[model samples]
Target chain A: MIPSSWYLILSAVLFTMGVAGFLIKRSLITVFMSIELMLNAVNLSFVTFAHDWHAVKGQIFVFFVMMVAAAEAAVGLAIIIAIFRTRQTLNVDQIDLMKF
Target chain B: MHLALFLIFAAVALAGAANLLLQKHPINAALSLIVVMSSLAVLYLLLGAEFLAIAQIIVYAGAIMVLFTFVIMLLNEGVEEKTHGSRVAKLLGFPAVTVFLALIASIILSSETHLGKVIIGESITTTQDLSAVLFRDLLLPFEITSVLILIAILGAVALARKDEQ
Candidate 1:
Protein backbone atom coordinates (compact mmCIF):
# COMPACT_ATOMS: atom_id res chain seq x y z
CA MET A 1 0.00 0.00 0.00
CA ILE A 2 1.34 3.38 -1.01
CA PRO A 3 0.53 6.28 1.23
CA SER A 4 -1.79 8.70 -0.49
CA SER A 5 0.20 11.62 0.86
CA TRP A 6 3.02 10.65 -1.45
CA TYR A 7 0.75 11.36 -4.39
CA LEU A 8 -0.14 14.69 -2.88
CA ILE A 9 3.55 15.47 -2.42
CA LEU A 10 4.23 14.65 -6.03
CA SER A 11 1.34 16.87 -7.01
CA ALA A 12 2.80 19.72 -4.98
CA VAL A 13 6.19 19.31 -6.57
CA LEU A 14 4.64 19.36 -10.03
CA PHE A 15 2.58 22.37 -9.12
CA THR A 16 5.68 24.23 -7.93
CA MET A 17 7.49 23.40 -11.12
CA GLY A 18 4.53 24.72 -13.03
CA VAL A 19 4.67 27.89 -11.02
CA ALA A 20 8.35 28.25 -11.72
CA GLY A 21 7.81 27.72 -15.41
CA PHE A 22 5.02 30.24 -15.50
CA LEU A 23 7.06 32.88 -13.74
CA ILE A 24 10.39 32.29 -15.40
CA LYS A 25 9.45 31.48 -18.97
CA ARG A 26 9.48 34.34 -21.48
CA SER A 27 7.37 32.89 -24.28
CA LEU A 28 3.60 33.09 -24.30
CA ILE A 29 3.07 29.47 -25.34
CA THR A 30 5.43 28.05 -22.74
CA VAL A 31 3.70 30.02 -20.01
CA PHE A 32 0.39 28.68 -21.20
CA MET A 33 1.82 25.18 -21.05
CA SER A 34 2.79 25.91 -17.46
CA ILE A 35 -0.82 26.65 -16.68
CA GLU A 36 -1.73 23.29 -18.14
CA LEU A 37 0.92 21.70 -15.94
CA MET A 38 -0.58 23.30 -12.88
CA LEU A 39 -4.00 22.02 -13.84
CA ASN A 40 -2.67 18.50 -14.27
CA ALA A 41 -1.02 18.60 -10.87
CA VAL A 42 -4.29 19.56 -9.28
CA ASN A 43 -6.06 16.73 -11.08
CA LEU A 44 -3.60 14.24 -9.61
CA SER A 45 -4.34 15.39 -6.10
CA PHE A 46 -8.06 15.31 -6.69
CA VAL A 47 -7.83 11.72 -7.82
CA THR A 48 -5.57 10.87 -4.87
CA PHE A 49 -8.07 12.27 -2.38
CA ALA A 50 -10.88 10.42 -4.04
CA HIS A 51 -8.99 7.19 -3.68
CA ASP A 52 -8.08 7.92 -0.08
CA TRP A 53 -11.70 8.44 0.91
CA HIS A 54 -13.17 5.86 -1.47
CA ALA A 55 -15.43 8.59 -2.83
CA VAL A 56 -16.31 9.15 -6.46
CA LYS A 57 -16.86 12.89 -6.19
CA GLY A 58 -13.16 13.68 -6.41
CA GLN A 59 -12.92 11.98 -9.77
CA ILE A 60 -16.10 13.73 -10.84
CA PHE A 61 -14.57 17.04 -9.90
CA VAL A 62 -11.46 16.15 -11.89
CA PHE A 63 -13.73 15.50 -14.85
CA PHE A 64 -15.23 18.96 -14.58
CA VAL A 65 -11.80 20.48 -14.12
CA MET A 66 -10.61 18.78 -17.27
CA MET A 67 -13.63 20.16 -19.14
CA VAL A 68 -12.86 23.64 -17.96
CA ALA A 69 -9.21 23.19 -18.87
CA ALA A 70 -10.11 22.15 -22.38
CA ALA A 71 -12.34 25.14 -22.86
CA GLU A 72 -9.72 27.44 -21.41
CA ALA A 73 -6.98 26.01 -23.62
CA ALA A 74 -9.03 26.52 -26.79
CA VAL A 75 -9.85 30.12 -26.02
CA GLY A 76 -6.39 30.88 -24.69
CA LEU A 77 -4.61 29.51 -27.74
CA ALA A 78 -6.93 31.49 -29.95
CA ILE A 79 -6.09 34.61 -28.01
CA ILE A 80 -2.40 33.77 -28.30
CA ILE A 81 -2.76 33.38 -32.04
CA ALA A 82 -4.54 36.68 -32.29
CA ILE A 83 -1.86 38.40 -30.26
CA PHE A 84 0.88 36.81 -32.32
CA ARG A 85 -0.77 37.89 -35.55
CA THR A 86 -0.78 41.50 -34.53
CA ARG A 87 2.39 41.65 -32.46
CA GLN A 88 4.49 39.28 -34.60
CA THR A 89 6.21 38.01 -31.48
CA LEU A 90 5.62 35.23 -28.96
CA ASN A 91 7.47 36.86 -26.10
CA VAL A 92 5.25 37.88 -23.20
CA ASP A 93 7.54 40.79 -22.46
CA GLN A 94 7.06 42.21 -25.94
CA ILE A 95 3.31 41.64 -25.99
CA ASP A 96 2.71 44.05 -23.18
CA LEU A 97 0.56 46.67 -24.86
CA MET A 98 -1.40 47.54 -21.74
CA LYS A 99 1.67 47.96 -19.59
CA PHE A 100 2.32 51.55 -18.63
CA MET B 1 4.91 -3.29 -6.02
CA HIS B 2 2.52 -0.36 -5.81
CA LEU B 3 5.08 1.80 -4.08
CA ALA B 4 7.73 1.00 -6.64
CA LEU B 5 5.39 1.71 -9.51
CA PHE B 6 4.27 4.96 -7.98
CA LEU B 7 7.84 6.04 -7.35
CA ILE B 8 8.86 5.26 -10.90
CA PHE B 9 6.05 7.16 -12.61
CA ALA B 10 6.26 9.98 -10.13
CA ALA B 11 9.92 10.32 -11.03
CA VAL B 12 9.02 10.35 -14.71
CA ALA B 13 6.38 13.00 -14.14
CA LEU B 14 8.81 15.13 -12.15
CA ALA B 15 11.54 14.79 -14.74
CA GLY B 16 9.13 15.74 -17.48
CA ALA B 17 8.03 18.79 -15.57
CA ALA B 18 11.62 19.80 -14.97
CA ASN B 19 12.43 19.36 -18.62
CA LEU B 20 9.41 21.46 -19.49
CA LEU B 21 11.03 24.19 -17.46
CA LEU B 22 14.50 23.72 -18.91
CA GLN B 23 13.56 23.52 -22.58
CA LYS B 24 14.09 26.78 -24.42
CA HIS B 25 11.61 26.08 -27.20
CA PRO B 26 7.86 25.94 -26.85
CA ILE B 27 7.49 22.76 -28.88
CA ASN B 28 9.99 20.98 -26.67
CA ALA B 29 8.21 22.18 -23.58
CA ALA B 30 4.91 21.02 -25.00
CA LEU B 31 6.34 17.59 -25.73
CA SER B 32 7.74 17.35 -22.23
CA LEU B 33 4.34 18.28 -20.88
CA ILE B 34 2.94 15.33 -22.83
CA VAL B 35 5.43 13.08 -21.08
CA VAL B 36 4.30 14.41 -17.74
CA MET B 37 0.66 13.92 -18.67
CA SER B 38 1.27 10.34 -19.74
CA SER B 39 3.15 9.54 -16.57
CA LEU B 40 0.39 11.17 -14.54
CA ALA B 41 -2.13 8.98 -16.29
CA VAL B 42 -0.15 5.96 -15.17
CA LEU B 43 -0.16 7.30 -11.62
CA TYR B 44 -3.91 7.75 -11.79
CA LEU B 45 -4.26 4.17 -12.96
CA LEU B 46 -2.24 2.98 -9.99
CA LEU B 47 -4.57 4.88 -7.69
CA GLY B 48 -7.56 3.04 -9.24
CA ALA B 49 -8.97 6.02 -11.09
CA GLU B 50 -9.24 3.93 -14.21
CA PHE B 51 -11.70 6.10 -16.05
CA LEU B 52 -9.90 9.28 -15.15
CA ALA B 53 -6.60 7.76 -16.20
CA ILE B 54 -8.02 6.98 -19.61
CA ALA B 55 -9.60 10.39 -19.82
CA GLN B 56 -6.28 11.96 -18.89
CA ILE B 57 -4.63 10.12 -21.76
CA ILE B 58 -7.32 10.72 -24.36
CA VAL B 59 -8.21 14.30 -23.47
CA TYR B 60 -4.88 15.65 -22.24
CA ALA B 61 -2.29 13.68 -24.17
CA GLY B 62 -4.40 13.32 -27.30
CA ALA B 63 -6.69 16.32 -27.83
CA ILE B 64 -5.31 19.21 -25.83
CA MET B 65 -1.69 18.47 -26.60
CA VAL B 66 -2.52 18.28 -30.28
CA LEU B 67 -4.04 21.70 -30.03
CA PHE B 68 -0.90 23.02 -28.34
CA THR B 69 1.40 21.43 -30.88
CA PHE B 70 -0.67 22.75 -33.78
CA VAL B 71 -0.49 26.25 -32.43
CA ILE B 72 3.27 25.98 -31.92
CA MET B 73 3.76 24.77 -35.47
CA LEU B 74 1.36 27.32 -36.91
CA LEU B 75 3.17 30.14 -35.21
CA ASN B 76 6.55 28.76 -36.24
CA GLU B 77 7.98 30.50 -33.23
CA GLY B 78 11.65 30.12 -32.50
CA VAL B 79 13.49 29.52 -29.27
CA GLU B 80 12.71 31.72 -26.27
CA GLU B 81 14.94 34.75 -25.76
CA LYS B 82 16.56 35.23 -22.41
CA THR B 83 15.58 38.26 -20.43
CA HIS B 84 17.16 39.50 -17.21
CA GLY B 85 13.68 39.89 -15.72
CA SER B 86 12.87 42.00 -12.70
CA ARG B 87 15.56 42.11 -10.04
CA VAL B 88 13.10 41.93 -7.17
CA ALA B 89 11.51 38.82 -8.61
CA LYS B 90 14.89 37.27 -9.16
CA LEU B 91 15.94 37.93 -5.61
CA LEU B 92 12.77 36.89 -3.81
CA GLY B 93 10.85 34.58 -6.13
CA PHE B 94 12.67 31.25 -5.85
CA PRO B 95 13.25 31.54 -2.13
CA ALA B 96 9.59 32.36 -1.58
CA VAL B 97 8.55 29.39 -3.67
CA THR B 98 10.93 27.12 -1.80
CA VAL B 99 9.49 28.28 1.50
CA PHE B 100 5.96 27.64 0.27
CA LEU B 101 6.89 24.18 -0.98
CA ALA B 102 8.54 23.31 2.30
CA LEU B 103 5.48 24.44 4.24
CA ILE B 104 3.15 22.40 2.11
CA ALA B 105 5.36 19.32 2.26
CA SER B 106 5.71 19.50 6.02
CA ILE B 107 1.96 19.78 6.43
CA ILE B 108 1.33 16.82 4.16
CA LEU B 109 3.99 14.74 5.88
CA SER B 110 2.55 15.59 9.28
CA SER B 111 -0.84 14.31 8.20
CA GLU B 112 0.60 11.33 6.38
CA THR B 113 -0.14 8.92 9.20
CA HIS B 114 -3.94 9.12 9.03
CA LEU B 115 -4.43 10.10 5.41
CA GLY B 116 -4.45 6.36 4.64
CA LYS B 117 -2.88 4.33 1.87
CA VAL B 118 -4.04 3.38 -1.61
CA ILE B 119 -3.64 -0.18 -2.87
CA ILE B 120 -3.29 -0.82 -6.54
CA GLY B 121 -6.54 -1.97 -8.19
CA GLU B 122 -8.36 -1.72 -4.87
CA SER B 123 -11.41 0.45 -5.56
CA ILE B 124 -12.34 0.80 -9.17
CA THR B 125 -14.96 3.36 -10.12
CA THR B 126 -16.69 1.89 -13.08
CA THR B 127 -17.99 3.95 -15.96
CA GLN B 128 -21.56 3.21 -14.97
CA ASP B 129 -21.06 4.70 -11.49
CA LEU B 130 -19.18 7.63 -12.90
CA SER B 131 -21.86 8.34 -15.47
CA ALA B 132 -24.61 7.91 -12.91
CA VAL B 133 -23.06 10.58 -10.72
CA LEU B 134 -22.17 12.82 -13.66
CA PHE B 135 -25.58 12.64 -15.26
CA ARG B 136 -27.79 12.41 -12.20
CA ASP B 137 -26.20 14.13 -9.25
CA LEU B 138 -24.28 16.73 -11.27
CA LEU B 139 -26.45 17.12 -14.32
CA LEU B 140 -26.69 20.88 -14.19
CA PRO B 141 -22.95 21.37 -14.10
CA PHE B 142 -22.66 18.82 -16.85
CA GLU B 143 -25.04 20.73 -19.08
CA ILE B 144 -23.34 23.99 -18.18
CA THR B 145 -19.98 22.56 -19.16
CA SER B 146 -21.40 21.74 -22.58
CA VAL B 147 -22.45 25.35 -22.92
CA LEU B 148 -18.99 26.39 -21.81
CA ILE B 149 -17.43 24.31 -24.56
CA LEU B 150 -19.79 25.82 -27.08
CA ILE B 151 -18.85 29.29 -25.95
CA ALA B 152 -15.22 28.34 -26.19
CA ILE B 153 -15.67 27.14 -29.76
CA LEU B 154 -17.43 30.33 -30.74
CA GLY B 155 -14.83 32.44 -29.02
CA ALA B 156 -11.99 30.62 -30.74
CA VAL B 157 -13.62 31.16 -34.11
CA ALA B 158 -14.22 34.80 -33.40
CA LEU B 159 -10.71 35.32 -32.14
CA ALA B 160 -8.84 33.42 -34.84
CA ARG B 161 -10.54 34.96 -37.89
CA LYS B 162 -9.09 38.08 -39.49
CA ASP B 163 -10.91 41.31 -38.74
CA GLU B 164 -12.92 42.59 -41.70
CA GLN B 165 -12.55 46.13 -42.85
Candidate 2:
Protein backbone atom coordinates (compact mmCIF):
# COMPACT_ATOMS: atom_id res chain seq x y z
CA MET A 1 0.00 0.00 0.00
CA ILE A 2 1.15 3.53 -0.72
CA PRO A 3 2.00 5.22 2.51
CA SER A 4 -0.13 8.24 3.26
CA SER A 5 3.02 10.29 3.79
CA TRP A 6 3.97 9.88 0.15
CA TYR A 7 0.60 11.25 -0.89
CA LEU A 8 1.00 14.16 1.48
CA ILE A 9 4.45 14.91 0.17
CA LEU A 10 3.36 14.83 -3.44
CA SER A 11 0.44 17.08 -2.63
CA ALA A 12 2.75 19.52 -0.94
CA VAL A 13 5.04 19.64 -3.96
CA LEU A 14 2.16 20.15 -6.36
CA PHE A 15 0.73 22.89 -4.19
CA THR A 16 4.06 24.64 -4.05
CA MET A 17 4.43 24.48 -7.80
CA GLY A 18 0.97 25.96 -8.19
CA VAL A 19 1.82 28.81 -5.90
CA ALA A 20 5.03 29.47 -7.74
CA GLY A 21 3.24 29.48 -11.07
CA PHE A 22 0.56 31.80 -9.79
CA LEU A 23 3.11 34.22 -8.48
CA ILE A 24 5.33 34.12 -11.52
CA LYS A 25 2.84 34.01 -14.37
CA ARG A 26 1.40 37.32 -15.52
CA SER A 27 -1.25 36.07 -17.93
CA LEU A 28 -4.71 35.96 -16.42
CA ILE A 29 -5.38 32.53 -17.88
CA THR A 30 -2.17 31.10 -16.43
CA VAL A 31 -3.00 32.54 -13.06
CA PHE A 32 -6.41 30.97 -13.23
CA MET A 33 -4.88 27.59 -14.07
CA SER A 34 -2.50 27.90 -11.15
CA ILE A 35 -5.46 28.48 -8.89
CA GLU A 36 -7.03 25.26 -10.10
CA LEU A 37 -3.77 23.45 -9.43
CA MET A 38 -3.77 24.73 -5.88
CA LEU A 39 -7.33 23.61 -5.35
CA ASN A 40 -6.56 20.14 -6.62
CA ALA A 41 -3.62 19.99 -4.24
CA VAL A 42 -5.96 20.74 -1.37
CA ASN A 43 -8.34 18.08 -2.61
CA LEU A 44 -5.50 15.59 -2.48
CA SER A 45 -4.86 16.37 1.15
CA PHE A 46 -8.52 16.24 2.02
CA VAL A 47 -8.82 12.79 0.53
CA THR A 48 -5.73 11.61 2.33
CA PHE A 49 -7.14 12.70 5.63
CA ALA A 50 -10.54 11.30 4.79
CA HIS A 51 -9.01 7.92 4.22
CA ASP A 52 -7.04 8.18 7.41
CA TRP A 53 -10.06 9.05 9.51
CA HIS A 54 -12.33 6.64 7.69
CA ALA A 55 -14.86 9.48 7.57
CA VAL A 56 -16.88 10.75 4.66
CA LYS A 57 -17.05 14.36 5.82
CA GLY A 58 -13.83 15.25 4.07
CA GLN A 59 -15.03 13.69 0.86
CA ILE A 60 -18.32 15.53 1.17
CA PHE A 61 -16.44 18.75 1.72
CA VAL A 62 -14.43 18.08 -1.44
CA PHE A 63 -17.70 17.82 -3.36
CA PHE A 64 -18.67 21.25 -2.12
CA VAL A 65 -15.24 22.55 -3.01
CA MET A 66 -15.59 21.19 -6.53
CA MET A 67 -18.93 22.93 -6.89
CA VAL A 68 -17.40 26.18 -5.78
CA ALA A 69 -14.52 25.67 -8.18
CA ALA A 70 -16.92 25.13 -11.04
CA ALA A 71 -18.76 28.30 -10.16
CA GLU A 72 -15.54 30.23 -9.84
CA ALA A 73 -14.30 29.00 -13.20
CA ALA A 74 -17.48 30.04 -14.99
CA VAL A 75 -17.60 33.52 -13.52
CA GLY A 76 -13.90 34.03 -13.57
CA LEU A 77 -13.58 33.14 -17.24
CA ALA A 78 -16.34 35.54 -18.14
CA ILE A 79 -14.56 38.30 -16.31
CA ILE A 80 -11.33 37.43 -18.06
CA ILE A 81 -13.04 37.57 -21.42
CA ALA A 82 -14.57 40.93 -20.60
CA ILE A 83 -11.22 42.25 -19.56
CA PHE A 84 -9.62 40.97 -22.73
CA ARG A 85 -12.26 42.65 -24.82
CA THR A 86 -11.61 46.00 -23.21
CA ARG A 87 -7.85 45.86 -22.72
CA GLN A 88 -6.80 43.75 -25.75
CA THR A 89 -4.26 41.98 -23.57
CA LEU A 90 -4.24 39.39 -20.81
CA ASN A 91 -0.97 40.47 -19.22
CA VAL A 92 -1.70 41.65 -15.70
CA ASP A 93 1.16 44.13 -15.60
CA GLN A 94 0.14 45.97 -18.76
CA ILE A 95 -3.52 46.28 -17.76
CA ASP A 96 -3.62 48.46 -14.70
CA LEU A 97 -7.05 50.02 -14.91
CA MET A 98 -8.07 48.80 -11.48
CA LYS A 99 -4.78 49.69 -9.86
CA PHE A 100 -4.65 53.09 -8.17
CA MET B 1 2.16 -2.14 -5.16
CA HIS B 2 0.31 1.07 -4.28
CA LEU B 3 3.63 2.87 -4.07
CA ALA B 4 4.19 2.29 -7.77
CA LEU B 5 0.77 3.66 -8.54
CA PHE B 6 1.41 6.73 -6.44
CA LEU B 7 4.70 7.32 -8.24
CA ILE B 8 3.06 7.02 -11.62
CA PHE B 9 0.27 9.45 -10.76
CA ALA B 10 2.67 11.87 -9.17
CA ALA B 11 4.79 11.81 -12.32
CA VAL B 12 1.73 12.52 -14.41
CA ALA B 13 0.67 15.39 -12.20
CA LEU B 14 4.14 16.88 -12.38
CA ALA B 15 4.14 16.62 -16.14
CA GLY B 16 0.78 18.33 -16.27
CA ALA B 17 2.02 21.13 -14.07
CA ALA B 18 5.09 21.56 -16.24
CA ASN B 19 2.97 21.71 -19.35
CA LEU B 20 0.76 24.30 -17.73
CA LEU B 21 3.75 26.38 -16.83
CA LEU B 22 5.78 26.01 -20.00
CA GLN B 23 3.19 25.85 -22.73
CA LYS B 24 2.35 29.12 -24.44
CA HIS B 25 -0.91 27.91 -25.89
CA PRO B 26 -3.77 28.36 -23.45
CA ILE B 27 -5.68 25.45 -24.93
CA ASN B 28 -2.79 23.08 -24.41
CA ALA B 29 -2.37 24.22 -20.84
CA ALA B 30 -6.06 23.75 -20.20
CA LEU B 31 -5.89 20.23 -21.57
CA SER B 32 -2.91 19.52 -19.33
CA LEU B 33 -4.84 20.78 -16.34
CA ILE B 34 -7.58 18.30 -17.13
CA VAL B 35 -5.06 15.50 -17.14
CA VAL B 36 -3.80 16.65 -13.77
CA MET B 37 -7.32 16.80 -12.36
CA SER B 38 -8.16 13.31 -13.59
CA SER B 39 -5.00 11.88 -12.09
CA LEU B 40 -5.97 13.56 -8.87
CA ALA B 41 -9.37 11.92 -9.01
CA VAL B 42 -7.66 8.58 -9.31
CA LEU B 43 -5.57 9.45 -6.28
CA TYR B 44 -8.70 10.34 -4.39
CA LEU B 45 -10.04 6.89 -5.12
CA LEU B 46 -6.91 5.31 -3.74
CA LEU B 47 -7.38 7.38 -0.63
CA GLY B 48 -10.86 5.91 -0.24
CA ALA B 49 -12.67 9.15 -1.04
CA GLU B 50 -14.54 7.60 -3.93
CA PHE B 51 -17.29 10.20 -3.98
CA LEU B 52 -14.80 13.02 -4.12
CA ALA B 53 -12.85 11.24 -6.84
CA ILE B 54 -15.92 10.97 -9.03
CA ALA B 55 -16.99 14.52 -8.27
CA GLN B 56 -13.51 15.82 -9.03
CA ILE B 57 -13.52 14.20 -12.44
CA ILE B 58 -17.02 15.41 -13.26
CA VAL B 59 -16.79 18.94 -11.93
CA TYR B 60 -13.16 19.75 -12.68
CA ALA B 61 -12.08 17.56 -15.56
CA GLY B 62 -15.47 17.56 -17.26
CA ALA B 63 -17.18 20.88 -16.59
CA ILE B 64 -14.83 23.61 -15.40
CA MET B 65 -11.93 22.70 -17.67
CA VAL B 66 -14.17 22.58 -20.71
CA LEU B 67 -15.42 26.04 -19.84
CA PHE B 68 -11.82 27.19 -19.58
CA THR B 69 -11.05 25.70 -22.96
CA PHE B 70 -14.02 27.48 -24.47
CA VAL B 71 -12.93 30.80 -23.01
CA ILE B 72 -9.46 30.28 -24.40
CA MET B 73 -10.90 29.50 -27.79
CA LEU B 74 -13.25 32.47 -27.68
CA LEU B 75 -10.51 34.87 -26.64
CA ASN B 76 -8.09 33.23 -29.06
CA GLU B 77 -5.20 33.99 -26.75
CA GLY B 78 -2.99 31.95 -29.08
CA VAL B 79 0.45 33.16 -28.12
CA GLU B 80 0.93 34.41 -24.60
CA GLU B 81 3.04 37.51 -24.41
CA LYS B 82 6.07 37.01 -22.23
CA THR B 83 5.56 38.22 -18.67
CA HIS B 84 7.34 41.36 -17.62
CA GLY B 85 7.27 42.88 -14.16
CA SER B 86 8.81 45.89 -12.53
CA ARG B 87 12.14 45.22 -10.86
CA VAL B 88 10.53 45.25 -7.43
CA ALA B 89 7.68 43.03 -8.49
CA LYS B 90 10.03 40.63 -10.16
CA LEU B 91 12.12 40.53 -7.01
CA LEU B 92 9.09 40.02 -4.85
CA GLY B 93 7.74 36.97 -6.65
CA PHE B 94 10.43 34.56 -5.54
CA PRO B 95 10.32 35.63 -1.91
CA ALA B 96 6.57 35.58 -1.84
CA VAL B 97 6.41 32.09 -3.28
CA THR B 98 9.15 30.84 -0.97
CA VAL B 99 7.49 32.25 2.13
CA PHE B 100 4.17 30.70 1.20
CA LEU B 101 5.84 27.33 0.66
CA ALA B 102 7.67 27.53 3.96
CA LEU B 103 4.50 28.45 5.79
CA ILE B 104 2.68 25.45 4.40
CA ALA B 105 5.56 23.16 5.22
CA SER B 106 5.78 24.36 8.79
CA ILE B 107 2.07 24.05 9.33
CA ILE B 108 2.06 20.49 8.10
CA LEU B 109 5.13 19.47 10.06
CA SER B 110 4.27 21.19 13.34
CA SER B 111 0.84 19.65 13.58
CA GLU B 112 1.13 16.67 15.91
CA THR B 113 -2.27 15.14 15.35
CA HIS B 114 -2.16 11.77 13.66
CA LEU B 115 -5.07 10.05 12.01
CA GLY B 116 -6.05 6.69 13.42
CA LYS B 117 -6.74 3.66 11.27
CA VAL B 118 -10.25 4.12 9.96
CA ILE B 119 -10.34 1.89 6.89
CA ILE B 120 -13.47 -0.23 6.77
CA GLY B 121 -12.68 -3.93 6.66
CA GLU B 122 -14.40 -4.85 3.40
CA SER B 123 -17.74 -4.08 5.02
CA ILE B 124 -18.16 -0.34 4.22
CA THR B 125 -16.64 2.12 1.81
CA THR B 126 -16.57 5.90 1.65
CA THR B 127 -19.52 6.35 -0.72
CA GLN B 128 -22.13 4.80 1.57
CA ASP B 129 -20.82 6.45 4.70
CA LEU B 130 -20.62 9.86 3.04
CA SER B 131 -24.16 9.66 1.68
CA ALA B 132 -25.53 8.74 5.08
CA VAL B 133 -23.93 11.70 6.81
CA LEU B 134 -24.64 14.10 3.97
CA PHE B 135 -28.34 13.29 3.82
CA ARG B 136 -28.88 12.92 7.54
CA ASP B 137 -26.89 15.63 9.29
CA LEU B 138 -25.33 17.87 6.67
CA LEU B 139 -28.36 18.27 4.49
CA LEU B 140 -28.32 22.04 4.60
CA PRO B 141 -25.01 22.43 2.76
CA PHE B 142 -26.16 19.91 0.22
CA GLU B 143 -29.10 22.11 -0.61
CA ILE B 144 -27.08 25.33 -0.43
CA THR B 145 -24.71 24.15 -3.17
CA SER B 146 -27.54 24.43 -5.70
CA VAL B 147 -28.06 28.05 -4.74
CA LEU B 148 -24.38 28.66 -5.15
CA ILE B 149 -24.41 27.15 -8.63
CA LEU B 150 -27.38 29.29 -9.64
CA ILE B 151 -25.70 32.44 -8.41
CA ALA B 152 -22.57 31.54 -10.32
CA ILE B 153 -24.56 31.17 -13.51
CA LEU B 154 -26.14 34.57 -13.07
CA GLY B 155 -22.78 36.08 -12.25
CA ALA B 156 -21.17 34.63 -15.36
CA VAL B 157 -23.93 35.98 -17.58
CA ALA B 158 -23.80 39.39 -15.99
CA LEU B 159 -20.05 39.55 -16.35
CA ALA B 160 -20.08 38.45 -19.94
CA ARG B 161 -22.75 40.93 -21.02
CA LYS B 162 -21.59 44.32 -22.30
CA ASP B 163 -22.31 47.35 -20.16
CA GLU B 164 -25.46 49.19 -21.24
CA GLN B 165 -23.98 52.53 -20.38
Candidate 2 lDDT tens digits, B49-91:
6677788888898889988988888888866666557345448
Give DockQ per model, in order: 0.78, 0.61
Query: How large is the interface RMSD of candidate 2?
Result: 2.7
Chain A TM-score vs. truth, each candidate: 0.96, 0.94
For candidate 1, give the lDDT of residue B17.
99
Candidate 2, clashing residue pairs?
none
DockQ of 1: 0.78
Question: Taking the tens digit of each residue's C-alpha lDDT, what string does model 1 give over B33-67?
Answer: 99999999999899888899999999998989999
- How close to the true structure is residue B16 of candidate 1, measured as C-alpha lDDT? 99
* Per-residue C-alpha lDDT of model 1 across residues A55-85, encoded as one tens digit per residue: 8989999998888999999999999999989
The TM-score obtained for chain B of candidate 2 when compared with the true chain B: 0.83
- Per-residue CA lDDT of model 2 for A1-100, tens digit only, reads 5456667667787897887778766678988999999989988887777677666787777887888998899899989988988888888688876765
- The TM-score of candidate 2 is 0.89
DockQ, candidate 2, comes to 0.61
List CA RMSD, all candidates: 1.3, 2.6
